[model samples]
Target chain A: MTKTKKIPVSLTLASNRDKSDHLAGFLSISPWLIGFILLILGPMLASLYLSFTDYNLLSSPSWVGLANYRSLLTDARFLKSLEVTFTFVFVSVPLKLIFALALAMLFNTGRKGSSFFSAVYYIPSIIGGSVAIAVVWKQLFGRQGAVTQILSLLNITDANLIGNPDTALSVLILLVIWQFGSPMIIFLAGLRQIPIELYEAASVDGASKWRQFFNITLPMLTPVIFFNLVMQTIQGFMTFTQAYLITGGGPLDETLFYAVYLYETAFEYLRMGYASAMAWVLLIIIAVITLIFFLTSKYWVFYQSEGGR
Target chain B: MHSNKRLLSDMIFYVFVIAIGIVMIYPILWMIASSLKPATEIFNNAVSLWPSAFVWENYPSGWAGFGGIGFATYFRNSVMITSIVVVGTLLTGSIVAYGFARLEFKMKNILFACLMATIMLPIQITLIPQYIIFNEIGWVNTFYPLLLPGLMGGQPFFIFLLIQFIRGIPRELDEAAIVDGCSKLGIYWRIILPLLKPALVTVALFCFMWTWDDFLAPLIYLNDASLHTVTIALRNFMDTQGSTSWGPLLAMSSLSLLPQLLIFAFFQKHLVQGIATTGLK
Candidate 1:
């Protein structure tokens, strides 16, 4: 009841509360904080250091300056992997996004079994990265496999698609494109968020269905398209299991993914330092691409809150 | 006339959807069917969906595995690692999410941004160094490399997801609990956690699916044949058997995917909804 005395007491109490909140916040997040330092941040710095050294697993790291990086520029497998990964990312991401967007549009028509169809489509995205799927893909495109048998009927004899350098990467791309369900689902969700009134308004203005799609739907869906593109591109670059298992980067290292090459360098050959350098280069590549995406997003990606660009 | 046009369009839509669905699902079905076909029948009748005779022997034979180990060991390893990883993800993810969502602290926004940035960070950068650290400590060829990261924070994506879910819960609930002298931990436990069921479920399913399907980590960490996971074992099976035993190979492949298929079947809604909300893996 005494105003001056109560004010002083309340100020101390508020400060006490703030102190507890700080302690509690830190305590609760300690697991992640500790992990971020030890697992991610520390390892990141260590890898950067290791990149300059010539350490195998057994030896002490001996610094070789930029030799490892310089060697990477001339490393044929490294260049081949860059080419393979770039091709995969450029080809598969767009094709996957196109298929996803098309299927998403098809399902968004409010047909009765659309959900069931979507669920069925999603099954592959769940298991597509597994060894089992890779094995299935190999067999499906192998010399004696079903695809060859079908193609042979059309005079495409002995067409071992997976064993051919020219078609091997495409086979992996097809497998990846087959698992377009996740992005399709994301697209479907984005489509649902587009208000029905926009289409209605477009129709009232005598806009054709194609016009409605271009003016109303596509402009609205650009954000989702951008999200899918960035994620799928990143994922496409890291694709290892399919190329590793299906082609073994084979016939001429045609399907050698960057991650697969890095794995072989580090674990298989025990070139820890060299692999570390490759990892850093990969990180830089991913960072640059993601930065480019974010920088470009402003021009194309429309946020409803921004009322269009 | 209008009704007829609508009916024809509907029919065409159904046919297109169903046809594409079949094409999409064919490889999976083929694998399942091949598992039951005889070795000769597997390739000779590759185009056929129906097996002339169901060779139930493939399952038992594939289960026998190689190097004196069995599919049973691989499966047990997978289940153990996946379950522990899922539980760890849920616990750490929810706790960290609570901190970010409810409590005001120094550098909170910066830390949250750090967490989000990690969601896009490629694993390759950390792979070699983490392996070095584990190898230095003689933790290589053990589950520590695979398990510790999950136990620590699971994934930044999971934490980000739970944080989004936690923010949606009314702050009044936390405040009322505070008035009752409930501690911050108590509010996280009694108020936030119970309300976090759906999001936790989404996290758990994803964690389980990803961990189970994960090949690279197990491939790097668990080298001993006895310590191999289902994915690694399947790869080994393919390597050793090559083309001699397609039936048993396909059998094991199908068996390996059974858990994922079952999870997807039962929790389709949760999985779809999780992707819709987070737009993440």
Candidate 2:
């Protein structure tokens, strides 16, 4: 050693501080970094490779490049799952958002105990997809379900909604719409963020509620709308427990969501490679959808804080 | 006249809110009511709000569970797993989030972006490979596969949430502590940890609830009857081929929902704040 400790107190202190700071930072975040590599990145690469091979857990994976993807083009179940998933996403996201925003707007008028009401409304979203809830929903739509009984009171008979293929998906969609709590909460937050002065000025200028909403509220809420859109779309695609528990993808595979189908393929049928390909395709679809939104967001989404569009 | 109109509108508003709240809570209310009803009465008066006869035996029967394994075991397993996960998540999540929020290090931006991007990647895409990895390490059929990821900063959502929270805390405290010759770890341990109580509580509540409610992982990983979670135990009630006992099933489900309902009622403020804060950003 060159007797570095005796060189100078301040010099050693400053240099040692930087080293310690860097070391501490590394040590602090290293867990996540290591986890991200082993769990996320490494698995992703393996999944990509697995998509091209025919791997069952029983044996080693054997390569057959593009075969799984090619098969997907002709696979009827795969196409049906995509159709079901896309329809579910496209239909449910807007309705849920609309319902959430309407309730949020209603609550945003600053009524007494509005928070209590909002919390009550959020209960379904908290436990909507639990097996218990799903089972309860199944009973609610069964032949002698609460819905059927109510429909009977209206002089309508034999209202078997869950058993019928035509209306089963609609029942699930209704369940999704019912659990619009998070978006409702987020919308309430966004609604609060809109400046009260803008609304006051609009009213002073003799603007009607509808006109003020169109000009003021909608523009201010676009960012939150966009956020909700992306999240709800992903959630729509990932809906599994409800479909798996409620319908079990029955009545001609009407509600066989992409995720449930992929799960059956991977775990039940043990077609791991095929399922991996399906998973990748699902990922790509979401990425492209989200990318399109991001690309088009600049045109419509106004950020008043970000240089005023 | 305007004041009368406002009063009438307020009346309408209260009615509307109450009606909507009833609709929102009807299913859960129906479940509790049906749980108390006899097996025949469940379907007989499915539309009815109240049970004609209260059958308290449903709770004991449901708790007895299937094939000698009771709901007590499932509840015990859930509590054990969730407690471990919550503790591990708070520890790892706060540390990683603190690093992202406060520390200056190389690759920080890239790493942060990577963490954010992982939030978008569907868990299914990584499911197969992870299953293989867990199997390779002989962690399958054990809680290790389900529990270890949470322990090792696997939940990026919590990390992102805590990072947003940690960012909101003032840096003056850290600076003052540094001037007092505190090391980086010392500042984090002494000041940041205590200040992070609210966020930590939110994180713990969410972790516990999500783990308790989680069915898919426990389903895929734990094949043994003994290691089944509450969700899976509830699922087993449906899986048996014979005539399904709706009373016992609904009774157990109502019991299972107690924790979530209690947590929501008590932590309504924190829950609302947590979502608004993390989600809006």
Candidate 3:
């Protein structure tokens, strides 16, 4: 009888401790929980609702039932922005990845002074998104700017690259491709994670350097490549400050990125409802592209832990 | 003969690398060189990296700033916002990470997944509604819109990063603290936080750089001219005076980049490590 009474008391004490732990856990994470609801989750739901309405900041929203999305299909600038953004993402991401991978291989050779070189290469990536760089780029590609002058020295006189419709998007692409340092750093880390023994074993089997690289390095680096591809693709689609500051999405809207167009729609024109719709469309586009990447990743991406399966 | 061939290849490699490095760094050098050049020389001598004469006046003139508001004001504003945001990110990020990393509760898996999902969610989705909400609260024009987000656990990336770091720490430390009559919060403060210094430094440095370089938030929220951050002021300076004075514009631009360069120079190890770890994971 005494043992049974003691057991019930101990059970109650353990229950009380568990309740306190649950409370503490909730309390500890309350800031992020509150933020996620207020800033992300709540806002996401509100935007979804607003996307189907006609609302400006000055007045209340009126339900319109997908009119904004319908109008989007007919919007020339919206279509153009999509084309420009798609072109930018497709062209820049691969070029950036290639450069990053190649340079990472060079640095991974374990040569003296590689770290210093890496640091030097990283400066542009650090500040390339700044207005200062964009401003400088505009001047650099202007009619009498340094690049034009240098081109004239070569007797290849072309008009201001920024002002030319055909070249404007390419200029922005080149600017982004120049800042491949971050991915290169990531690639470097990934390369280091690849074991030297693989290369050694390949060499022992009388494999040529090119053969070793194709068979081992390339397959091993697929996961890192996928990560870089996904990140750079997302970033490339959202290319803004460069296009906004340098070209102002101009030369007949050839450089109009989606985010720049969205900003113009929302703040510049104050068409909050339409902009919200555009935002959802963009979210959907990113989601679809990311999903495609994940689905395709299994075919190419190699995990050593899975024993090459 | 083999040693001689190897030496020759090394020489070729160094030359090639140096040449590429020059091309990479030339634009920045040109911007700095242009800032010190005379107005006439800016365009005419654009190809030349070395100015015939250094115009010391550009610094002072740029410091004088546009419309009676100086660059000093913008710099001060940036420093204030950046410092507070850094502190807030550390505090909130650590607290939230500890909860996720150490504590067990109902729906922890779901909440954790939600945290991960937000890391990939684009800001554009929430931008409009957030603006409307803040506007309704009469907080649109104030720094509250800018400051509150940082205080409210900042970016999910930093929180995730801290969680990763916290998980690597052994649970034995926490158990010992509990045995010593420590509360959960006490264990966090006395044990986890002290052990989390390296990761905190990484988070702090990133918070400082990103907050300092942030343009969009300050652009949307701080509409008053006097309330402008360096980025906004720089853009406005270009709009009003870009064509008239390239020297001062470039000079001010260079000034705006100084803090970033200084941090990169000093804390490069932390920055590189942060990127590598995040990418690998």
TM-score of each: 0.98, 0.96, 0.97
Model 3: fnat (fraction of native contacts) = 0.69
lDDT of each: 0.91, 0.89, 0.89
Please report, as a residue range, the 10-residue window in candidate 1 chain B with the lowest summed lDDT.
B272-281
Worst 10 residues of 2 chain A by lDDT: A1-10
Candidate 2 DockQ vs. native: 0.67
**Residue B3 lDDT, candidate 3, scale 0-100:** 96
Model 3 Cα lDDT, one tens digit per residue, A1-309:
664667777878977887888899999999999999999999999999999999888889999998999999999999999999999999988998899898898889888889999888888888888888887898898879999899888987686888899898988998998898899999999999998999999999999989988899999999989899988888777677788888989999999999999999998999999999999999999999999999999899998889974
Question: Which regions in candidate 2 have their CA more than 4 angstroms from the true location?
Answer: A1-15, A155-159, A307-309
Candidate order, lDDT descending: 1, 3, 2
lDDT of 2 at A73: 99
The ten-residue window of minimal lDDT in model 3 chain A covers A1-10
> Which candidate would rank higher by lDDT, 1 or 2?
1
- Compose the digit string of candidate 2's lDDT tens values, residues B80-198: 88889889999988898988899877788999999999988899999899998998888888999788868777489889988888989999999999899988888889999999999
Angstrom error at residue B247, model 1: 0.7
Docking quality band of candidate 3, CAPRI definitions: medium
lDDT string for model 3 (B50-116, tens) is 9999987898999999999999999999888999899999999899999999987789999999999
- RMSD over all Cα atoms, model 2: 3.0
